[model samples]
Target: MAEPAPRGITSADLEAVPAPLVAEILDGVLETHPRPRHAMAAGELAGELIPPFAPPFARGRGGPGGWVFMIEPELHFGPQVVVPDLAGWRRGRLPAEPATPFVETPPDWACAILSPSKARLDRGPKRRIYAEAGVAHLWLLDPADGELEAFALTEGRWLLVGTVRRGEMVALAPYDAVPFPLDALFPLDAPAAPTET
Candidate 1:
């Protein structure tokens, strides 16, 4: 039988690892999961999706804005330190930035870009942790399937708000302030050449 997974990942477990590696301290065990082929591309794609909204909610320059969204923010909840693909906070709740490198307060919203290698952890343990941390909204993006699923926490349980498939434009909370085009999140290989008649 395979050895049982560690009870939880600790910060020390990740100390020796190189900076290039992506790792998270889930529950209490150190998880160094494999990186998927599209993980970097998916992360970059996520970075692109936010600029359009930055002027409005993120920086609070205009619009019905009251949010601060960040990419790959290091979050600390109790003894656990987890990093989500994207994390957002209501400006009112976090008037000032934390002095520490990692914020202890849980984010109001978080988005996780799914990859084959990290899907299980993101959907399972990571989801549970986010719920426990009192995240109000959650979004999961699957690049391979070109899908985005949004959920809201109801009494600490996740209730599906909606799902956006490739080629579909959707406005899902809490970012529903603006509609997002699924295709824009994942770019296509290239334009097909016209066939000669």
Candidate 2:
């Protein structure tokens, strides 16, 4: 006889998780992990993008100001509930205030600040889910490695568009309106990564 199928999971299961721990459902399973000690890149990334791309008062700032950003917004794409480190929506797509605390409409861009425990899940299941939901862009910012990887959804898959390491300035697609330095997102005093032969 075939083995018994596991029961389906839901958002309520995530709500039941205790405080200080983050919960997410992946591939029909509810998983929880302790939050990262520091999300420096996530914080710094918001600093860089919001001033230029985000709205309400960005119009006169000299940067293209037609996007709206949120930090750690709970996004529901079908039964999957994902909270990206940072997410953005073009103003035209989200012209008005959202009706609920969580958003069901997919974002134009989503960036994940990868922690040790969540890296595998973000790069695997979560990435797949984003592609399946037709998210236009995805970025992975690894603070430990001081690197940022940008991907575009092309032909129903993620195609890596660019990678910028510490101290480099980049102007990448979808958000190529303004160039920013990668150094701004990583700490100046962090130890250098090991070099490969």
The best candidate by lDDT is 2
Among the numbered candidates, top TM-score falls to 2
| TM-score of each predicted structure versus truth | 0.80, 0.88
Model 1's TM-score against the true structure: 0.80
Off by over 4 Å in 1: 1-13, 34-62, 189-197
Tell me the tens digit of each residue's lDDT in model 1 across 1-197: 11223655445555655676667776666666554466554565555445545445345433356667777777887766678888888877677888876788899999888887778888998898999999999889887776789999999899999987766676888766656466665555432233343
- Across residues 43-159, which tens digit of lDDT does each residue of candidate 2 receive? 888888888888755676668889988888888888777888899999998887688878888999999988898898889999999999999999998887778899999999999
- Residue 10 of model 1 has an lDDT of 49
lDDT of each: 0.72, 0.81
User: How does residue 66 of candidate 2 score in lDDT?
Assistant: 90
Query: In model 1, which residue pairs have backbone atoms overlapping below 3 Å?
Result: 8-28, 8-29, 9-28, 9-29, 9-30
| Lowest summed lDDT window (length 10), candidate 2 | 1-10
